[model samples]
Target: MKNILHVFRHDLRRATSNVMAVIVLFGLVVIPSLFTWFNVIASWNPFENTKNLTVAVANTDEGYQSDLVPIRLNVGEQVLSALRANNDLNWVITSEDEAIDGTKSGEYYAAIVLPPTFSADMMTFYSNGSEHTKIEYYTNEKKNALAPKITEQGAGEVSTSINEVFTEKLSEVALNIITSLSGYLDDADTQATLSRLQARVSGVAAQLRAASTTADMFTSLIASSRPLVDSASGLVSTSGDALQDATGALGTGKDAAQSLKDVLTSTTVALGDARSGTADSYQAVADSVDDVFSSMNAQSASSADALGAAATRVQTQIDQHQQLRDTLVNDVRPLLPESAVDSFDRAVSRIDASIARQQDLHDRLDHAATHITDTDADVQAMHAEITGLIANAKASVDDAQSAYTGSLQPKLDALAETLSVIGGDVDSIGSDLSSVAESLSGSDSLTTALEHAESLTTDISSTLTETADRFDALANALTKAMDTGDLSELTEVIGADPQALATHLAEPVSLKRVPVYSVVSFGAAMTPLYTVLALWVGALLISVSIRVDPPQGAASDLPVLTPTQTYLGRFGIFALVGFLQSSLVCLGSVLFTQVQPEHPFLLILTGWVMSLVFTLIVYTFVVTFGNAGKALAVLMLVVQISTSGGAYPLQVLPQWFQNISPFLPATHAVNAMRSAIAGIYQNDFWVSLGLLAAFALPALLLGLVLRLPLIGFNQKLLRALASTKLM
Candidate 1:
């Protein structure tokens, strides 16, 4: 360890005396630091000046009347005033051309231009949907970035304020127009007209209700009348049946009477012959004939009387049936509609025709029986007269029979037929009544549904009327409020109302940032490269100086120590000196420039390690090859310096340079030092330290192995010098 210290002190003294080392330290340390200081100054505060912004506008608008007032508000002036009033902005108003030039020269960051017809165009757009009005913003590309952005934000705020104001004013004018129109409608005539219309609608509603009720009542009455018609038809049928039975009884009695009359006439004629001796019979025949005649006469008289009574009863029944028919035709038929009455009349007429036909048939029967009366005329003149009287009675019976059978019986039969037809008609009428009842029920249901619908409609109408009334009240209030026209109180709510001239001053624009610091400058970036190169060159020179002399006595004539002693001595001295030099430079940089050391100890250690590796490599060449090794050291330094990324980041360097960079000790040292300065070192610092150690160790071991030959050369040179001294 004492020997190592001796060698360490000796190499350090040698490095201090080397001219190349002095030059390397000055160039690498001093020059690079000055450049870094200049870089920091150039890139200063870029956003500070953006707070005081300026905008310019030009407007040549001709104002027009709005809502019967002359609109003399200059839009451009109003916009400029609003922007100027804002605390964040310092707006400078100017002509369009001048503003553009000022922005381009960076005097103003942004400028606004208001077109000449801005007011007229905006009004036209509102009234007629025109597209003539436009706002334009101009921004300088060379201005600071914050300046243009602030100007754009200010313009947007101004536009929003103007829109609120304009909309409020327009609403006021519209309300005034509505108020004037409403005043015209407040007269009495219109009110009276409306009242009359209401009354007419009410009348129509009442009439519709009455019509509905009447239709329902009519349908009910028709339904109730159907059963009565059915009952009347049943009564007519019963009457026809009774009349048919009476007529049948009367016919039976008339037939029996005719038979008895024939028998009586035959018996009387036999008695007459017996009594006139035209018979061959004795007193018994005459007496029998007399008795038979008398019995036959009595039976005939009784049969005739019975037949007359039957005929009379039949006539009475017929009279009752006729009376019922007449009553039906007169009373019930009149109550029916014309069509029903016509049907009843037709039925009655059919009955009458059938009666006339029966009467003709009865007359033919009466005529046939008249000859029997003529044959019995002269048996007893008084009896003949009686027979004549019976014949007359028979004729009367015939007449009565004819009346009953022909007229009455036929009328009854016809009435029965008519009643059957009427019953059918009644059945049809009942079906019609049923249909009418169903239709009436459906109509009732429909009316109920309609009533519900009408109630809903009335509710809807009432709601509509209420809404319209509320709307009219709202409109009146709004109209009255607008007529006041004092919108100063609304200014807080509506904000700034920009004139038509300033409408064109609202828009957004972009600005390109001009760099305050030249970050891409060549000199600022190259300082680190030169610093790394000088350090590597200085380390190589120190390594060469220590390897210049051999050991005190050795066979070889080389002027360096053995390789092992030479490498250890030089590397030890270089490590200490490099550490001192790195500490001094970093201290100077921090004190003078803004450059800070992220890891002070690591940076110092990296410098020491790099110096040791450089010293070992230089010792290996010089100890192995004597004076010729100096040229080899220079070549190695140049190669390592060129490959090291301290000059530029490794990414920007050629692919081959990056590949060989880790092999060089200077490359590792620079990377480690930069990491310490930048405060970003992690894997890079550790990896670089390991690589430098690898190079330093291997070089030191190789120097140690070649030291034997160097020591022998040193002994030989010392002995030769001794022999020269003895001679």
Candidate 2:
């Protein structure tokens, strides 16, 4: 261990004297120090407390003509005014050419140019619906970073202002158009046109009203005529009933007369037979005459009974007619006019009187017929007795027959003529009923015609009412159209101009002035890592210098030191020297550059840890492959520097490069250091520390293992001599 320390001290002293080693150390310390300074300067707040930002504007738009005003403000002027009014910025208006030159030369950060036909194009956009006359901004891209961004924002603001003005103007124009339309509609000519329309509507309405009124009158007339029609219809029905009743009575009378005629004929035939049989057998004739008289009497009695029944039926008919007459006068008559009622009453009375007369005639006829039948029966019996008595005296029988035939035949013929006259009277009454029925039928036809006319009138009234309702709707629609007055007003209430409205509400933009600052050049962020790399290269050179020296004399055969002490001595000396080099670099940055670290102690500590890790790595490789290990260290340095995203973020590198970036110690160191400098708190600092520890601890242990055989006094002198030539 004593010899190893002695060898370590000898190697360190020789390393300090070598020109290449000193030069390598200086390059490592100075180059990274400058890079770190530049990075710190680049990251400083350039825009802090920046004020009075200058902005450029160019407006070339011509004024517009309005109906009420000769000239109106152009869109460009409106944009300019809006920018000037903004409290966030100070706007400077310049000609288009001047603004452009000033922006490019960094005199002005941003420039805006309003198109030549801005107002005219906008009007054309409104009138012809074209998209033209876009607002444009010119900005200096390289001067200050914020300048272009501010210019972009400013151009947006100007566009917004122009849109707002255009929108407001358009709204005013719409309102004015509405007002103009209202005036035009209220003028005499338009009002006259409306009046003509109203007159036409009113005329149609009047016609409808008249038709309605006429319908009402027709309905009233129908109401008034209904009673008369009803009465006529009732009279027709009643007359028909009366005629049917009279026809039925006539049928009954005819049937009874025919039966009575048959009975009378049968009686006459029996009487004649009895009279003829008396001469053939006087006694037998007398008996047959008695039978004949009995038969004749029965038949005559039946005929008389039939005549009585006919008379009673006629009497009943007369009573029914009288009742009908009374009912017509008391109940049905008042329902008709006085003349018609009286006429019906008279007809009923006449029918009743006729029925009474017929009844009397039938009664007289029946009584006379009954008397004649009884007389005939007596004569038949007497004739029969006389014929029997005369048959005994045969010469007087013919004379008796002549006397009986002459008297009975004349009375029977007179009865037959009376029955025929009564039947004729029944026929005449039936004819009268038929005439009344025909008159009632004619009245019914007239009543039906009146009902048809009433229905037609109702249909006409309904049609007229529908017409009036349609006219009312037309008038209301016309009134609403007149009240609205303007098409533009309708368009606005209905979301007609969506794009213009959207443009109007957007935020106004102005040119943004970016404060100028010194920018760090490319690859400046990786300066500290590069410096650490240069330090490792310088350490390798020193290690080679110590190893290549010639051996001293026959060395003491002291046992080799343990791998731990031998590796520790090499690792410790390099670690301390690398740390001293990193400290010098950080000190140079603070002194020469205006780089102020937020946490100076932590920054220094991080640098020290990085140096130790690099030292262990250099020692491990050097012990493993001797002088050839220097080439591996250089390769590692290249990989670390390339992978570390210091100058450009790792994201900007190719994908494969980004994949291997975490394994590079330089990458971890750069990220951790940037986090500290930028006040970006992150867990990556500890992680980076751990990764560096892994590299440093393992390299130190491995170097110890590899150096175990060379730990003795003589072996250390020989290893030092070998390291010197390799440097």
Estimated TM-score for each candidate: 0.32, 0.38
Off by over 4 Å in 1: 1-531, 541-547, 554-561, 570-576, 619-644, 647-649, 680-684, 705-727
What does candidate 1's lDDT look like per residue over 1-727, in tens digits? 5556676665556556989966654554444334444544343233344456666655555544565443454444455556566555666767888888888888877777777776656555656557855667787756665566778876676666555444444444433433343343355653443344335544554555555555555445545554544455455555456545645644554444344334434433432332232112222222432343344344545433433343343333334334534554554443333434455455556545433433333332233223223233332342333333333433332343343334433443343344445445544654554554444444545555555555555555555555444444443433333444333432322234433212332332345888532323333234345445545565554544333452454643224454455555545655564455455544544455434456656655665565556655765666665555668878776777668876557798889988988777777677666666555534888886787678866675656775566667755765776798862
Report the CA-based lDDT of candidate 2 relative to the real structure: 0.59
- Per-model CA lDDT versus the true structure: 0.51, 0.59
lDDT of 2 by residue, 157-247 (tens): 6676677777666555543443344455768776666556656766787778788888979977986887776687577667667767866
Best by TM-score: 2
Of candidate 2, the 10-residue stretch with the lowest lDDT total is 515-524
**What's every prediction's RMSD, in angstroms?**
29.4, 30.1
Candidate 2: Cα lDDT at 563:
50
Query: How many clashes (backbone atoms < 3 Å, residues ≥3 apart in a chain or on different chains) does model 2 have?
Result: 22
